[model samples]
Target: MRRCNQCIVERMDSPVPLIPQLAAHLVAAGGKRLRPLLTLAAAKLCGYPGTAEGGTRHVALAACVEFIHTATLLHDDVVDESQLRRGLASANAVFGNKASVLVGDFLFARAFQLMTADGSLRVLEILSRASATIAEGEVLQMATQNDLGTSVERYLEVIHGKTAALFEAACRVGAVVAERPQLEEDALAAYGTNLGMAFQLVDDALDYAADQAELGKTVGDDFREGKITLPVLTAYAAGKEEERLFWRRVIEENRQDENDLEQALDLIGSTGAIAATLDQASAYADRAARALAVFPDSPLRRLLADVASYTVSRGR
Candidate 1:
């Protein structure tokens, strides 16, 4: 992880002014770095420590994973028009949207540079496909914005592309580097895909109910942005006709009054939307845990399973 962090910092440095600074503004703020961690752990599980003894491929790949993730975050904040990220001014907010987007593009280019250096066409294919899918996911989300009629299946499709695709690639690449069998690679990808789903669902639930301190961003940012998430969908689906109208007003028409957030919260809470969303997240979390069953019962496998279980707790 330390090596991956250092690699991220080093690779992000550039002679071009403003790029590194803008990238640092977001990266330095710090995030869980969970995607890169998954790469390392998956490699270890497949019998690669990514250290001096085994090999150093995992470290660079992990950094590449992180770079891909950070690039997405930079783009996401601009698309969402988010002011805060990790409880600090977002890159788009601190710099400008144009700078943030360009810096994000630079990071993506750096990621591909790392991939090309690795000389693995397979790894290149996985990461490149994930990057493209992420863009499609973001565009799909935009298409669904303020769409109260968006189904849960459609929501899952968006998250699978935007959030889960990188995770799946991160883990699958681990096996690829380790020369693990195809089944193991498939299992690791499944673990990542389900885990990513759980993580995003919990995040959606948290957006409606968590403290700004814990959430690291505004609690009602999703609501204010008219982003269609499962919680709002659950509430809107179960709401009375008048309540549905309220969803249409705030979510579809983007006509949120000062008290509307509170009202939305009440409806979400009263309709058990948060709990329902958490339960759905729990289901995915369990799937993530089950996906690791193919792996031998080692500490890494156990730890990864624990991570799947932990995603459920994060929502609570």
Candidate 2:
């Protein structure tokens, strides 16, 4: 963890003062550090010798993964026009979009530098592919926005690319650095992918169910942005003709009135879309746990399993 922090600090030290400040602010809005933890835990679970210096490469790689993720968040806030993130004002909201975007680019370049310093072509390949996939996912989601025809299949593809790909790469890269067997590396990669998918599904569910304070953003944000997520998609699919018409008007026609929020919530509830979304998330969680069955049992493995369990139980 200290190594990861050092790497972050080193990357943040920049000739451009504004870049460092913005990067610091974004980094201070800390998350679960689940990506780095996944890397460290994967190394341990793969039976890497527990020497004081054994996992330094994994730690560095983990930090690199987090840097890439945080950089994307800064840019995403700008693109999404989001005000709040992690319970505080987003970098773009505070520093303006231009600064945010440039700083995000700085971080991306720094992450690349870190990866190159590691000198592992495998790590570079995984991260480069994940970055491309994330960009593609963002574009796909943009294309599908406000379109009621955004099917479950399309939604899954978007989330897998946008959210799960990085998580998958993190775990796989850790295994690669630890010199794990090919089969074990594949299993960990699958575990990360499914876990990431489940994690995003739960986030979509909470967007409807959680309070503004708890969610750290406005409820119905996706809907207000004309973005159709799982709950709305499922509800729209199962709703009555009049209910479908309501969704079409709000989502497709972009005709939301003040009363539309309650109407949308009621319709989603009526169609049990939230429950169905929960079921889907739960299934992905189960699949993530199943992916770990090939690995030998250890504390790290147990923690990974617990993380899978917590994905469904988390508030946001």
Candidate 3:
């Protein structure tokens, strides 16, 4: 998956040379490739008929998913004004926002080109819908920023659209390419969705609880950005009167101070928000593993299950 990503970025040509450089920056700063791995695992578990011809299509389609994901990261960094991604300077921070946005558009076009080459209308449709959903989720999150009333339910909905939709679509495309039965397709899709949700839950917990260096970004970043996540939601729900007032000032009044961050962290710790969020993440991981029970046992299936477990176990 990583090599395919590198190759695509290397093959890219842009009228603006900076765009290719931005694309290379985005691609080279590696992530787990969890989405593509899910695609491959789904294909294997579905008993894809072994054929040399199918392998190429599978790989191309997987690369297409990663491209779409990378494009989103480029745009997200621009929107979030993020300085760091994958422990390196974000494309927007390094190459400037215009270059990042334009390069992201190039990646989107390249992903479409790859999809067309695969000749799977189903794959195309799933990815297109997922893209739309992801956009809507971003807008929803933007709308809700710093709003103390943002419920846990709403937060879950946002992550489902912003994060899990792509994961689900990736698995769905894998099944489509493999010509899997409907039941198997549904199972893989469910597994991906649950896994993605768990991944995000852990991320939210880490935003408040992790060391700055270990997280590859500043701690309390979400709070500073006024993006309320799971731990904050839990703390808000369970906080004392004074703690609620603290939230009102930091989140509502935009009064973030060092003391405010410490207070928020204290509230999160005292209220058991971090532990609660971890429990939720573990539940989602369990659901993800359970979704694969219908498939015949194999190393690929076991690896998929392990990946789900690892999502929650990851050190931020």
TM-score of each: 0.98, 0.96, 0.95
Ordered by TM-score, highest first, the candidates read: 1, 2, 3
Q: What is the lDDT of residue 87 in candidate 3?
A: 81
Candidate 1, residue 251: CA error in Å?
0.8
Overall local distance difference test of candidate 3: 0.83
- Give the better candidate number (1 or 3) by lDDT: 1
User: Which one wins on lDDT?
Assistant: 1
The digit string of per-residue lDDT tens for model 1 on 1-316 reads: 9988889889999999798788677677899989999999999999975477859898999999988898898889998899989999888888989998898899899999999999999999999999999999999999999998899999999989889899899999999999999999999999999999999999999999899989998789999999999999999999999999999999999998999999999999999999999998899889988998998898889999999898879878
Q: Highest TM-score, which number?
A: 1
Clashing pairs in 2: none
Pairs of residues clashing in candidate 1: none
Off by over 4 Å in 1: none
- The global Cα lDDT (0 to 1) of model 1 is 0.91
Which pairs of residues clash in candidate 3, taking residues 3 or more apart in a chain or in different chains? none
Against the true structure, candidate 2 reaches a TM-score of 0.96
RMSD of each: 1.0, 1.4, 1.8
lDDT of 2: 0.86
